[model samples]
Target: MSLEIAISIVMTLVIAATPILLAGLGELVAEKSGVLNLGVEGMMLVGAVAGFITASLTGFTPAGYAVAALAGLCASLLFGVLALTIGANQVATGLALTIFGTGLSSLAGAGFVGTTITRLPALFPQGLAGHPIFRIVFGYDVIVYLSVALTLAAAWFLNHTRPGLILRCVGESDASAHAIGYPVTVIRYLAVAFGGALAGLAGAYYSLAVTPMWADRITAGRGWIALALVVFSSWRPWRLLLGAYIFGAVMTLELYSKAAGFALLPPEMLAMLPYLATVVALAVIAMRPSRGRLDAPRCLGKTFRAGA
Candidate 1:
């Protein structure tokens, strides 16, 4: 590819990766804090719908994102309550949360079908006026910049902050944290809520800056991929960022390859790139027989009773 083509490809990857990066980062925080939130996909759906509806009504993209994030936070908070406070099964509650989110989204967005909104504008000014490299690196709507910032912030917070230390403590051993007066349940609750907000923001980015339209299955399976990426990244924020972009590049290349007359690969294979990458990564991780065991929280998915 020529320099211009290369720049274009990189730009496409950056655009494609923005949403996944957001979701993956959120999942990273949730998991690192010692909670297995299986409802990320559901949270994304709720965000998409909530953002779409609010944006359509208010004609303001920021307001849409705000409501969407709140909606996602509320949805994920419910799941945290079930899995942490009530001591429900994490897997079951997560599955139920997905179902509930899907149904609620459908009901909420039924009237907004076939609608479209003028998405939020790109943030880069003269920097991207005609500079291909600069545009590729800095050009994009507000969501993309925010997502990237969040990634850096998350990485820094997780690796170098007191709250992050407490979070990691809760994830590694809630009992230990509680004994040290860490308020394990509260920490987990907030972590899950933050995760939800990010997930929602990711979904809103899709609706407001990507598709900019309301539709069912809008999120497709991006949520699952984000979940997979968290595991593939070993719950590291920066690794999660890298993995998400790779997945995003694969997704974009799949489409471009098919459209660009590259008949070298099967159409089906291209279509399966996202899910296939997840499986391949998981397999690679699984094959490392000598790899150290994961340091999952002692009571990560278990309910925390106050005095039980």
Candidate 2:
């Protein structure tokens, strides 16, 4: 490939990876706090529709992002109430959230189909930002930058901060945490809410930053991929960033293949490569007895009861 083409590919990879990294970081935080939230897909869909509608109505991308984050946070809280408060199964609740998100986004976005909007403008001035080659480094909107910052912050908070240690304590042994006078449920609620917010932001980035339009199920299973990414990273923020970029490259390759009219592989099968890659990676990870199941927090997926 030409240098220009390589640059284009690299830029596209960064764009594709940002949302996954954002959502994965959020999920990583929640899981570290001993909560398994599977409704990221649903929350992302809700955020997409909510952001699109809000931006379309008000013509303000920032406001739309705020609404999207709020929408995701609310969706996550719903999961928290069911799974944490009422003691519902985390996996089942997460599945229900995804279903609800699919239906809700579709219903809300029905009127906005086929419409498009101007992309979010770049932050830097046009001189450097307009350069075809240089734009790769300076061209992206705020969300892209925010993804990197969040990744760094998550790493710092998880390893360097006192509250971070406490959060890890809760995840490691909630019963012990509770015995030590920590409010296990409250901490978990915060973690889930934070995760939902980032997931919503990721979904919003789809409408406002990536495509800038409304569509049914616009997230296209990226949320589930993000969930898998958390596991693929062994619950580490830095690894999550690396994993997101790797998956992003795979996704970009699929698009490039289609555009190049490469007829060797069927289009349908080509489309499946990213998902297939995820499954195979997960399977390989699972088969590793030392790393697969035990890498996650010990209290993950377990219902925490204060009285028990």
| Each prediction's TM-score versus the true structure | 0.93, 0.93
lDDT by residue (1-308, candidate 2, tens digit) is 67788788888999999999999999999999999999999999999999999988888888899999999999999999999999899989989999999999999999999887666777778876778889888888888988999999999999999999999999999999999999999999999999999999999999888888998999999898899889888888998999999989877876776677765567687667656766776787789877657378999989999979
Report residue 118 deviation for candidate 1 (angstroms). 1.1
lDDT for model 1:
0.82
Cα RMSD, model 2: 2.1
In order, the Cα lDDT scores of the candidates are 0.82, 0.89
RMSDs, each prediction?
2.0, 2.1
**Candidate 1 local lDDT, 224-257, one digit each (tens):** 8888888777777777788888987887776666
TM-score of 1: 0.93
Residue pairs in candidate 2 whose N, alpha carbon or C atoms collide under 3 angstroms: none
**Can you tell me which runs of candidate 2 are displaced by over 4 Å?**
261-269, 275-293
Clashing pairs in 1: none
